[model samples]
Each structure stands twice: as structure tokens, then as C-alpha cells.
Target: MSLGDDNGYGNDSGRTDDAYSTIGGTRQTRTRLPDGEGGDGYNTPRRPARASRSLITMAGVVVLLIAAIAFANMGGGDGNGNDGDGSGKGGSKPEAASTAATGTKPVTGKNGTIPSGFAHDEQGAQSAASNYAVALGSAGMFSTDTRRSIVQTTHDPAVVESLVAALTKAYSPSFLKNVGLNEDGTTPSGLTFVSRTIPVGTKVTEKTGDTATVEVWCTGLVGMAGPGSTKPVSATWFTISEKLKWVGDDWRIESSSQKEGPTPVNGDNRASTADEIAGAVEGYGGFTYAR
Candidate 1:
């Protein structure tokens, strides 16, 4: 997903300057004459007054303008609400705490199946893609059985077998140990392995019926949390672009690619003690994403 302005336009200042230059010069300003509107200082010709509009006529024009505006909005008025929050109508909805506090609804199929339940809207697609990225990057992908399950659950069934095989080769034993896990992908005794992906947001690069290319940019905690641990869990950021198909009643990835971080700097807060980190890791649980 692209992480840039969805509006794809310049700001008001640029618009204003362009409009002014079009009309006259860029520095042009509006100024009323001293005798403007024929006050006591009136020197300009006393312009002929026109007949006043009938109240009914004025009211009719106002009603017509309002109706026209409503019609345009119904068709698609750029998705921006009058509230100025940048979130469109689909994004400004309420959400469940268990699924994350994002103000968006779960993607649902028309018949309550996979990608089908997804909102046939951009925000819904973005939300779905983001969660899918997290589940794809999880530590579960390192184990053969769990890796197959993860891929099958999150990917289009038609491509699952091949993708699973590719992933199995990608997450080698050495790669697991390099990230602070044993060759078998388990943490050593007294340490809790931490490999969880949390998505910050998503962007849709392209879309069409039954297909979309989306990028889910995520920050993850990966490592071991235990006493005397030299390698504590830390964050990594990456973007996972997924090619999706509307399958099993929802969007499923056909394939995905990951890239390194554009991550922000870490804060100076004191790090949690190793024991505290281990306890927290054991006590807390992760999420089962929908939208």
C-alpha cells in the first residue's frame, strides 16, 4: 500500500494562488471603492437597481442547489466527510475493542464468507490488507505445520500449496536462530519467544472487482524476553504488498513481498526489566484479525 495523501491534490494555498494567477496576477487583491455600494462618498455612477427577487423564487433556487449537492454526494464526492477528519463514511464507523480500536468495520461477505464480507469500499480493503500482513509475518510461519496453516488461512486456496512451499524454504532454521530462537523455532528455557506483527496502517495501490494490490506497513516485536537475555524483543518495520483475490467470501493473498523499515526512532524511556518482559509476554495474548 502506498503511504501518501489519498486526495492526490495540492493544498488550498496552491489552489488559491493558481486561481489568482489565472484571473489576473498572483499578487492581485480585492479592494472596494470608497463609494462602493453608493454610500455618502458615492462618486461612481448611480447604477440602476434591479428588481428584487420574489421570496418564492429565492427559496426555490436554494432548494435546487441543496438537491444538486445531495445528488453529487450520493454518487461519490471524493469520500471526504464535512467533519474534516480525512476518514470517509466507511472509516468513521464504530469498532469492537477485541479487534483493535480502528474506527472501521470488519470485512464481511454478502453471505458471511471470506473476502466477500469485506466492505466493497477502499477503507475496508485497507483494513483487511493490514491485518492480513500481520498474520502473514507472524512467527507461526516458521514452523512447517503452523506455516502451512497460516498460509492456507490467509491466502487464496488456489495458490496456498505453492506459497506454503516457498515460505517453508524462506524461513530456514538458521534464520529462526538468528532472530533469537532455537533451530526448531522455539525459545530456550526461561525465555518467551516474541514474534508478533502489528500493522500501523495500509494503503491500496490499485483495485478492481475481485482483485486488489495493497501494501500493509507494519511494526513488529521479535526476539526473546527472559532473565539474563542479551537479545530482548525489539521492533522492526516493513511493508507487505499483497495481491488479493475475493475468495472464500473474503480477500485472500495470492502472493506478497516484504521490504525493510522506514521506522521512526525509539524513545528514551527506560527499557522493561527482562523478567517483567517475560511475564508480560506470557500473560498477554495476540489477536485474531477479521477486517
Candidate 2:
């Protein structure tokens, strides 16, 4: 299913400088005129005059160099040093908040490969949402029994029954056929049914002692993989917003909704063949996502 398509179904270089002049090895002798002859020429000695001029030139060069360095450090050279919002005067702008892992250990508990026993705090809520997204978007959701297990495990107990019923109808025979699966939700022989969600990140938008609203940004591969398969494996990006409650000493999903992506531009990489896609999906396992 598309993230939004959960009709009762589960959703979601530098330079250098130089100075000075040189002369032949032998110093030129200077003829001194009497103290006040002509030319301010009391033999004031030309070497010191030349040396003073050289020193001034070198000082000017140094000043210019310092100014250039300061400008660069202030991000005047490239705009990257400036915070996009214009709040920073860069000496290395603070890193923008990111979805990168916070180094918190992921939930180690599992209910049949689906993560469980999430902590009751905000991080736990986010972790719950992300893992729930994966479970809800998995290929198992196409089958009745597995789907029931997933719903029962991840959803609030109060709502599990109704959700199971709705999802059963949502994955009706027609829907299964449309997605290249059989009446019983199994792939045709030699074909691999692919329905996997990879969570890009999770954010807790609102939270309280017992409730949280989280948004999981995700990308998914759905459809079938095989020779001549009409519904080739394809990727979609979307966000799943779930309301979670602290229930049974762990976080469970209360409800969820989805929408189209905060998608990024596609890369220019070559698309893989169906066999290759199938192999990759089968070979690589998923992760326990955490915020």
C-alpha cells in the first residue's frame, strides 16, 4: 500500500607571497657628499631606506592576508558557513538537528520479529512508531494470520479487534490480485511479493506522560518481482503519523494516518533488474529503528 493508501489496511586552495630585494654579493660603496651638499644626500645610507620601504610593504601584505582569513572564517567566502536561517555568524556553524541516531540502544524485545517493549518516554514512543511502520508495511500484512499477529502486537489492545477487521477487508481478494498476489495473499510461483517499509527517521511532535504523536518518514518497495511482472518493485516516499499510548507497560499505537512525502529528488543511478531487486530484498535484513 502507498503510505496514504491504507483503506482499512496497514499504512506506512591557498597562495604564498614574498618580500624584499637582493643585490650582488659585493655591497656597493656610497660616496658621501659633505653634510649639506645637495639631494638630502648627507650619505644617510640607502640600505636603511630600502629596508624601511621593504618592511612597510611586508606589513601591508600581512594586513591584507589577515583580512582575507577573517572574511573566510566569517563565511564570507562560501554561503555554507552561514546558517540557512541566517542566525549564525560562522566559525563552524552548529550542526543542524538531524535524524541521525542518538546512540540510544534500540529496543531488544521482539514479538515475532517486530520490535516490542518500547520504553515509555519520548524516545521510546518514536522507536515504537518506526518499528510499527515497518510491521504494518510488511508483506505479512497481506496475509490474514500474520496481519492479525502484527495488529495485535503493535496496536493498543482496545483497538486491535476493529483494526484487524478493517485490515482484513482492506486486503480483499481483489486487492490481493491487483497487487500480484493470489486469493490467499501468497505470491504466484516463481514470484516474490515485496512490501517493505524502511523508516528514514522519526520525530515526536507532541508528547505527554502517556501519549505521543510521532511522524515517521519512510520509503517503501511494493509490488512483485519476477520475469514479466507487471507490477515491478517500485519505491515511494511518505510520512506516517501515529498516535501512541503507554499501554501494558509499553508503547502501542492508538491510531495512524499517512500522507505523501517530504520527498527528495531521485538520484541518477541505473535501475536494477527484477531479479536483482528480489535478491537484494531477500538478502538484506531490516533494522530496529530508533530516534
Candidate 3:
């Protein structure tokens, strides 16, 4: 759920000067005794050996210095960068994409109850994670039919069956009863079972052409809403991490996990009555998320 060598100086006059090479901040001084002296050179010096032995040492040091600087530059990168030409990694990458709205329209289609037609890009991955979190956290996950639909619609085909089985086992009769639902996962005659996720924000923590890891920070409603309901609807805060594969032109979750949140302190507002909560839920429609 959450979370690894030379520097040289050369003097003129064809004299092999005693060479000092700094590699990785460690300086090495070598005494070159003409061609008879033994030393490791990174490259063959243009000048003849006896005269250019120190130059060779310098060349080796220069090569190492460049390599060290290059390695240093490549070290601290976020590993999500690309050269504009797409030929290398960790070039002068553009500024990180902001989490604020990008003005792009949200997806306009649905894969059954789930949103479809997400873009084949990072934004699309974020959207998929957000919407999938909502579907997975919703009341549909408690019902067998809708649960299967939610799992199949959002999960990668390779794992859909397994997820379905696991979720079915997890939402057993006792679990349902504990949550005030009927053994069959139905709402009681006078009660409305509320379970819905609202994504506060979505982030693409990792991304590639065909795979992505997105984290969706969410707040959800979970409980029963009706008069005399002991399980009154309450708000929950958490984050959902979704590993998505670009499967068949759309993002499907390969795996998913949840963790308790960066939740805020409880507010002082009075709790709404069960009837009011149910009415508000029915009156409010969910949304299709986007970057």
C-alpha cells in the first residue's frame, strides 16, 4: 500500500609531469617514469607515450569526472522523466504536472456502471483510479450482482475472478449483518444503506506507457440511514492505491489497496439526523472525475 576514478594535470614541454588525478573527490598522485612507468589510462593519448603519459592520466581523470557528474545528475531524478525525443531517461524534464484541474473534459462513456473512454495518458490513469475507488467503496460492493459488475468493470481481466471471490468472502453474511445490512446484502424495508466514496484528489505516483500507480485520497459515507438506525451514516477518510494496466485501450486495475488517511480533526458541526442523511444522499448525484 505504500510503499542504489581519476583526475590528472599535464604540463607542456613533452615532460611526463607527476600527475594527480581526482576521482570521486579522492586525489591520486602517480609518478610516471617515461613509457616504463605503469598507469591506467582511460583513453590512448594523442601524443607519444613517453611525452604524453601525464596527458593520458589527465584524460582518464576528465573522463571520470564527466561520468561522475552524469551519474550524480541521474541519481536524484524521480525516474519519470524522458528526453523530448523519447530516446533516453531523466533529461531536463518539464515541471511536474499539477493536481489542479487540467480543463480537459471527463470521460464521456461508461463501461457498464464504470466510466469508460478514459484518455490513454497519465490523466486517464488518475481518472480511472479515482472512479474505481468510488465503485469499489460503494454499496454495490456489498451486493453479489453489482459486486461482480464492479469488480469485472474495474479490474484487469486476469484478476477479476480472484478479486470477486476474495471480495465475496470478505463481505460474508456476518459482515453484512454487522454493517446493518440483510444477510443477502439488501437494504431493510425502512432503511437506506449508504456507502459511497468521494475522491478528494488523485495522483499518479508512478507512470509508464502501459502501467501506472495512482493514489486516490478519498472521503466516503458508510452506514445505514433511517429513523431508529443504530448504524447512522458516518464519514470516513482514506486513500486508495491502484495499480493500473493499460489493457485493451483502457485502464483496468491490476491490484489495489487502501490505507487510513491524512484525515482532518473532527469538526464541531452537529451530526445530521439519519433521515436528513438519507435525503441528502438521494438528492445528490455522484460525479465523473478527471485530472
Report, for every candidate in turn, its global Cα lDDT versus the true structure: 0.40, 0.48, 0.49
Candidate 3 structure, TM-score to reference: 0.67
Give per-residue CA lDDT, model 1, range 1-291, as digits (tens). 011123221112111111001000000010011212212221232222211111110000000000000000011112211221223222333234533445665544322121335665556566666555544444454456755665566557865564444335434576555545688867688777555556555555566677766655455554456765545544444444555667756676554433334568766566666677678867887553444
Ranking by TM-score: 2, 3, 1
Residue pairs in collision within model 3: 6-61, 7-21, 7-22
How would you encode candidate 2's per-residue C-alpha lDDT over 48-73 as one tens digit per residue? 11221111100000000000000000
The positional error of residue 171 in candidate 3, measured at the CA in angstroms, is 1.9
lDDT of 3 by residue, 120-230 (tens): 887788887777666665556557887678667776787656445544554467756765679998989887866666677766666678987765666555556777676
Q: Rank the candidates by lDDT, best first.
A: 3, 2, 1
- Global CA lDDT computed for model 2: 0.48
Model 2 CA lDDT for position 36: 24
TM-score of each: 0.57, 0.67, 0.67
The list of candidate 3 runs beyond 4 A from truth reads 1-97
Q: Tell how far residue 278 is off in model 2, in angstroms.
A: 0.9
